[model samples]
Target chain A: MVIEKIKESRFTPDVFDITTFGTAFADHMLLSWYKDGKWSEPIIKPYGKLDFTPAISVGHYGQGIFEGMKAYKGETGDVYLFRPDKNLERLNKSAERLDMPQIPEEIFMDGLKALIDLDRQWVPSTYGMSLYLRPVMFATEEAITARSSNEYLFAILTAVAPNYYNKPLSVKVADRYSRAANGGVGFAKAAGNYAGSFYPTHLAREEGYDQVIWTDDATHTFIEEAGTMNVFVRINDKLITAPTSERILDGVTRRSMIELAKAEGIDVEVRKVTVEEMHTAHKNGQLKEVFGVGTAVVVNNYVAVGYASERLELEDLPETESYGKILKKKLVDLQMGISEDPFGWRLKVEENLVEA
Target chain B: MVIEKIKESRFTPDVFDITTFGTAFADHMLLSWYKDGKWSEPIIKPYGKLDFTPAISVGHYGQGIFEGMKAYKGETGDVYLFRPDKNLERLNKSAERLDMPQIPEEIFMDGLKALIDLDRQWVPSTYGMSLYLRPVMFATEEAITARSSNEYLFAILTAVAPNYYNKPLSVKVADRYSRAANGGVGFAKAAGNYAGSFYPTHLAREEGYDQVIWTDDATHTFIEEAGTMNVFVRINDKLITAPTSERILDGVTRRSMIELAKAEGIDVEVRKVTVEEMHTAHKNGQLKEVFGVGTAVVVNNYVAVGYASERLELEDLPETESYGKILKKKLVDLQMGISEDPFGWRLKVEENLVEA
Candidate 1:
């Protein structure tokens, strides 16, 4: 295993303020190959472009999978991966759904840490900022057949994101359109899942909305997810969210919220949440809070909702002890190592832990 | 109009292959831009790969729309396009669905004729094959936001394909997945639509099958398209197919077949086709022919269907004078100018049309 502790062949780092979206390569990158039958031994190498042809499968067909996570730079300058295991689990799920090879977690983590160690300075010190890490797997086979390719490549990219947004956002209830359906690959973070939302998202933006809320495919009646976030509705005192099924993406932050809610003695219901029920709750003035949970934004607070033809103003939606705010604090505290380990969620990188 | 005609920036006459897919380029390509609020001027230029980045939304997010048409080298070597208007209409429909700017029918046809006159020899002399033309549009903006990009590129490619399949093959009735749903992007020729099918098609290949018969999202009750090819079932001497909906792609070839069936006085029913009905037909021996219709494969014949732990053998299924085969021949003859087309489907491109 020590022999596998490889070094980057090219180690040049640059500092730029070009709003950094996916072009800056770190010193090293994770590499794995799938051929014959299984994934090869994962290797970490210099983060250079892999000499891709213009005719690659990902170019013609969107045969790609990606996992987005963050490495936090604590107040003490210690770096930690917040629930990296969850990211890895989701990556494997996405790979399975896309028919791409599942990467072994050990190699995934090892390569990620190696890349992070090489580009530690790129991690920003801003309060809300973290180094956004993107691990991607894609079809490398160049055959023009409309089937799964025999070859694939996996790599990781890191970029410093100062802040996802300026403040809490307004959201809409899904009046129409769906993200994924039952027996679809919504549970996995497949690239197709993300690609399909762009059009509707654009329409939402045109309608003066930042993101969209997706409903169930069968009837468009039940509330599902919003873009990539798992939605929560606080009605009458319970933190209620739709249950994770084939249609809903099993969000990591959504799960963390459920656990924190239970731990803090707040009522949480993971069940089918209907738009009609929410409309009724709004009518009754019991719809206290409606927010979304995801890795990119943590708990994004929401202030308004769009039902059929009218907008429901949820201006006073937050509770005295708001679940979204509390969950965000608890989640960040665990990520930053201020809280005691209750769920064993955080994975402290080797250099982060002090020697006894 | 003559100035627009002499705006000659097309390809030279000889740079084409007798047998290759997407390797040959037409002399000129049509271009249109969507800016400020509407589509810009349409221009014709020498065919080339438009400049793009690795992270262009199309390359990463599968933001592409495409249409397939063919210019036929007639029996007398006269060149023509079969239903260029249909392709343009479908293209605009797809564009609207994907939020892409519509290509004006006049510009689209003008561009086609320009390319056809420039590269008429590329239209095959062979019988089973034709010049496969691909018109594609994609997001060119370098933004990573999950909304529609402000910039885009559109290009058309020419390819000569000899045979759609090495052999006729089997397709599996999708027991595990659905391709697209109601209020989904399935009706459009969205690039993401193809990406989603790669995995299930891979599984079908593993099970000694070629394609998957996608079903409705809520229940795998009704038989939809064959992922790419539109499914047409000959049941009890009637040509039955699933009605076009948001969940089903409105294929140009499929539509043509329905129209052709009417002219041929063949019983054609464009309605909901249930899996149970197909199975019962096979059992009672009323199922005649099951085939697929698309631009790549004009009529792809299927002989069997597979499901979970059970393979329903349609080998004993009856055969008919395939509406699939008849329409294919009619379509080919019309393009080839050997048969009369009352519908004005063929567009003559070569100046030598009168001499031929």
Candidate 2:
């Protein structure tokens, strides 16, 4: 690996507002290229613009995939990455599904560690603040033909993020629009999957909802996802969510939340949770909460679900009584190094490891 | 409009092979930008690289759409575009579905004519050759947030093309994978929609088939598309094709062929064509032909179909008896200005229009 360190840092932690997520970037980034059936040596360089031909395959064909992760600064000044391996694993899965080349684990983990260690000061020290890392791979071949490109670019960009302070969400249960098909790329974090949802989400926002709760494409009855995150519906004391299928993303946060809930003695059922069941539970006063889990917000509670012409308003429970709140706190505490490492989910960034 | 002419022409039409297709581009290209709430003035400049941040929204979220068109060199040394308006209409429809800003008609038409006029030498003069035009629009916002971009880049790139000499295709009837969903962006020429099909198409190719005959996502029993083109099945003498739906592309060539067939006194039926029906027709020796129509290949004949464990081999009729050949020749003749434009679909590219 070649390391080209930035001569001067451009980021000012004192003046930067972490809450404005995805706006500010760190001084350095990591890039690797896949060409001629192999990956080039990873390069660490200053964050800047890239020069590409207008006919690059990704621009016209959308053969791109990305992974979202975060790095937290512990109270003792140590930087912690929550399950970086999982991100790398999922990234490869997305690459395979999109017919792009797989990123080597060494290239992903080593490059990620070195870049974060080089820009360690960019990791926000506040309890809920972290560095949001976006690792994206896209076709870089300069061609207009609709085929899998032989050349690819893999890049990792980091931004400072603060705790989300937005209010609980009100989402519309999708009745006509669908996010994924039975055998589609929804299970992968493909760039096109997110692009396909923007218009539907915009329509929902215009209807006074924050986001959309995507349902099955074939039936539109079973819940699949909430916005870009895996959704969970709480009824009475049981937590229910759709099982991971080809049409639903297997989110790291969703998996972590389920484990955290199980360990906390909560009844978590991983099965198909239909919209009809949610409506029935709401009518019977058994539906307690609905939430979405992902890397960005960690867990976002949904206060209302709009289906057809009716809005089912969920009762907002106190923080102590909210399962979403409890699980989020537990997960956050574990991620932030404030709790014992029972699941070995956190990987520390050591200065010595960077040199090695 | 700003015109930055190239200092020297880079194309050598005498030495260039048009059959290579999309490998060589003309010297000049057109570009327009959408920022704030309006489109900037269109610019025609030397075809070159574009500078973009690695975090450009399209690279991560895939808000991209494109249109395919061709400019034919008439026998009298004039240029003509067949159904340019249809391409523009479909492009905007794709843009709307992908949540992109609509390109103005003037920008599309004026830029196309000016660019073609500027690079008139690049147009292949061979009888069966033309200039292929690719107009692509993508999100250019420098952010990783998964939302519709506020800024976009629209560009038109032209390449010399020759007649395709590919052999008749063998296709697989999709059983485990689908190209689109009931309520998805499949009908739009969205970049993501094509990216999602690369894997499934790759699998079909590995199975010794040239392309996939995508079936309905809900049932895998009804045919929707043949590869990226609109498909047609000829049972006896009547041409049958699936109606345009939320899952099938409204192909320009498909529409033209239907009209051409009707004008030739051939019966055409626009309805759902199921796989079982196709199988029964083949067993009864009534399935005369199956073909795909698109802007790229105009029309491609399918010689065989692999479904389940059986391969249904189609008889190759003589060129005179082939419906695809008959309609393709009629359409190509009208496009090349060798025949009368009965439908007024051919638009002459007047030299005066470039000055306007």
Candidate 3:
């Protein structure tokens, strides 16, 4: 591994607003370059701008993929990452979708652990705050032809984020736009999937919604996922969520919540969830809660769901014994070492690398 | 307008290999920056690398759009662009779909004309070659939030290239993977739309095909378009093509071909085309020719098409008096100033800008 130290730390936690989600960056970033069909040793360098030719493939063709996870500063002065291996696996899946290169676990895990150990002080000690880790891979080859790039760049960047959502959200059922089609890259974190969603999500925001509840592209009848998270709706005391398909992301947070629900003896069903079923449940007063699960916000409850001209205001689940609340608490507790890691989801950062 | 001249040319036509598309750039490029809700004055500077922060919005979220066009060096030593105003109009249309700002025609047209005028020396005068111009706009804001970027960069890069495809292509009909869904960014030239297509196209390439013809996202019953072009099939003297909708790009070349067909008194129908109908036509010996229309390749006739486990071999139409050959010749002649422009589609560059 290669390392380059900065002359002085440009940021301190005191001056950096810890509540911001993705603005404040740490001192260094981990980077790896792939060229001539070979991967270089990972390097830790001062965070800065990257030089790019105007014809770089990613800026034009959108051959890019990314992963999101977090590192927590535990009470006992240890940093732990929840299922980093899972994120690494998903990143490679996205890479395959974009026809980009795959990243090995050696560089992904070892480099992350080393970087986190050296910058342990940057991790926020506050309960709500954690270091947000972003792993991004993109094609750097300079061309405009419709083909895969031969050169690539991979980087891991960290920022301090307290929480993504402060209150229950109001979401709109997507009617005019579709997020992912069958046999699409929805299962992968491809950059274009998010790009194609901005306009539709913007329209939903204009209609007084926080995000969009995307539906299957074919029929627009079955519920797919939320903006960037997997969704779950509780009706008649039963947890119902859409099954993972090619049009839906297999989220780590979503899987953890399901495991926690099963452990608590809650009836959870993973299958096709239709908008019509949701409307039927809401009318019968059986729909109790609606929430989304993702790495950014472990569990974000939605207080309302809107479909066309009809609106259904859900019960406020933040202060109740809702499934989302319990799952969030259990996951966070396990992450911060406040509770036992029964599922073996936590990996401790080893402080064995030499200081830069 | 601001102008920055280079000391010497980085490339010359004699040494530039026109066969290798998109690699050899001209001497200068035109660029414009958008910040704080206003566009800057257009600038013409030497073509080179662009400095970008790692957190640029397009790299993470895919807020990018682009346009493809060409400039021809006429026999009379004048440079002509084919309906550049149409490209400008479509660029703004694509921008609106992505929630990005619209570019005024003043900047788009004047900047392109000025750039071509300055670099007119690089325009290929050969019959089969021309100078390809690419206009691209992307979000340059340094943030990761799922919102529109406040900053943008628009650039026009030109490269010399001969015809993209010399031989007739063999394409596959997409059965599992979809290119664009209804009410998605397929109508617009969004970068992510192309990104989501790489994997499917790669799979087709592995099975001995050059491109894939997409189908409707809902039922896969109706045909949409080819990888980057509009599809046209001739059956019993009738030219059948799919109508442009939210799921299909309104290609300039496609529209031009339709007009030419009508001018020649050929019955052209712009309606829904189904895969089943095509197979029936092929079996009945009525499907005479199938071709793709686009700006890159004026008209690319397909030699064969594959769907599922079935293969349909088509005759090479280059020697026949096919509609595709006739349309290609008429369009190229009008572009090169060899024939009269009846539709007023050509824009000649003024020789007022400083030459290199």
Candidate 4:
């Protein structure tokens, strides 16, 4: 691979702060081009403004997709990436849904690894601090027709940030609006899916809730997901989550937690979870914990669930031995290389790993 | 309004063709900036590229809204705009739905008229030709949080094009995927609303249809708009269409058509038209004509409607005395100043209008 490096660094590293997420960029970024049924070799260049006319298809027709993953530094000098292959697979899935060309494994994996390796100094060494990797693919063709563009631009950006959530969240059950519908692009991390969710989420925030728990678009009866994360509900000692479908995102974190719980001999139910059933469970004092799981925050505990005029409060779960805390600890330990790799989930970079 | 005019134009006049809808832009574009709770004075500059950082909110969270309108050249070298006030009003309404700042009437109207008058030659003089005006506004603030941005960029680009559709279209009734849900941004002319419909429309096109007639998300029972335009059904000499709600765009062309039909002694019914009702009407041989109305294409006749294994064909309506033909003619005549402006719909450009 022929990679181009900048002469001097333009970015100065600062302490990672969780409050300011996605605000800074590293000194360099990886960019690759696709045209005429072929992709050019990836190159790392200085992070600066890109030249794009106003008529780009991604700006008008919304044919952009992205993926979110993290790279962590272990206590000794080892660097690890948590299931990067899964994120790359999901990125291709999103591309397929948007009528875009699928990215090859060499470009998606090698480009990301090489970019991270070159900027290894940006990776934080402190505990619970990691580099957030954003891999984006968008249409670069300058036309306004309602069709897919032939030209595309793919790039990866990294930001060093701490954990997103510091406390448990309060959520409301959405009764009016929906995030995505049946047979829609909700499963993919399409850019437009995030855009339509802002207004409803803002309404929930004004109502003193941290986020909204979306239900199915057909009847608003069955639970779907939180806009940014997959949701999990605990009834009795069984963990119940909605199955991965066209209406729900196949989150990597959610999948890992499900695996960890089942491996620990816990009963995990991946079926249709209805809001009415959850209300009934809360009424009977059987619904114990509800948390949102995603790459940003592995497990965000929900302290209150509001539906209409009723509220189900589980304020004591954060301090207790809840599933969210347990799964979060296990997930972080595995990510930071503090615990044994039971399922071989961590992939070590070439330079940082010390041979046993 | 401290306007800035470009010293020279980089664009050359090109032939108007329907196939090249938004390919070429005119000489100058209108631009306005919003910051610190105020909008800057409008300006007109040479149509060129725009500088935006990768972290802009619109590219990440989708805080973008737009409006589509047109300008026509009259017989004696006069340029006219049809119902521009309504377009400006709808643009602000869309802004309100997306949680963005509303564009003041002075800036939106005055800036648009000034820009069009300065580039009057771009307005095609042929009978069925017009300059398509696209007014777009997007978030410009560089941040990653899922909230509204403090800065915004509003610009208008013009392209001379003939009618969008030359022949009547064949549309499919969406049975599985949805365009918008209840209490969503469907009515806002939002960019994301257009993005989500592309994949489903692509599927419909592969099945030999030009567009998809979106149904209500909850039941798929009631017929909504056709994703891009407002739909109308004519049964037994009466024109029936779905009422505008949060689920449908309140199109300016649709409102003009309704007024024109009422003036022509035609009964226009604005109510919920269910799929079952339309199917029964078609089966009983009462469905006469179906057309779509919007600013892009004044009135697009539907030659066939496909639902499941059934196809209701109306191929002969274009040659017959169909209401779509009559309404389209009336609209174009009124826009080009060939017919009297009964409702005062046409606004003449100040420099192009001759004193009567």
Candidate with top lDDT is 2
Model 3 backbone overlap count: 0
Instruction: Report fnat in order of the candidates.
Output: 0.29, 0.71, 0.61, 0.44
- In model 2, the runs with Cα more than 4 Å from the true position are A352-356, B15-18, B163-165, B352-356
- What TM-score fits each model? 0.86, 0.98, 0.97, 0.94
Regarding lDDT, does 3 or 4 come out ahead?
3
Cα lDDT tens digits, model 2, B235-348, are 999999999998889999999999999999999999999999999999999999999888878788888998888899999888789898889889889989999989999988
Summarize candidate 4's per-residue lDDT along A128-165 as a digit string, tens digits. Answer: 77888888887778765556788888888887766766
Best by DockQ, which number?
Answer: 2
Across the candidates, what are chain A's individual TM-scores? Answer: 0.89, 0.98, 0.97, 0.95
Over 4 Å off, model 3? A15-18, A318-320, B318-320, B354-356
Q: Return the interface RMSD of model 1.
A: 3.5
Worst 10 residues of 3 chain B by lDDT: B11-20
lDDT of each: 0.71, 0.88, 0.85, 0.81
User: Candidate 2's residue-wise lDDT over A1-356, tens digit each?
Assistant: 88887888887857347456686889988999889999999999999988987788888999999999999988999999999999999999999899998899999999999999988889987877789899999988887777888899999999877654367889999999988988888899998888889888889889899889999988889999975789999999999989999889899999999999999999999999999999999999999999999998789888899998899998888889999999999998999999998999999998754442
TM-score of 2: 0.98
> DockQ of every model listed?
0.30, 0.80, 0.71, 0.51
Model 3: how far is A158 from its true place, Å?
Answer: 1.0
Which number leads on TM-score? Answer: 2
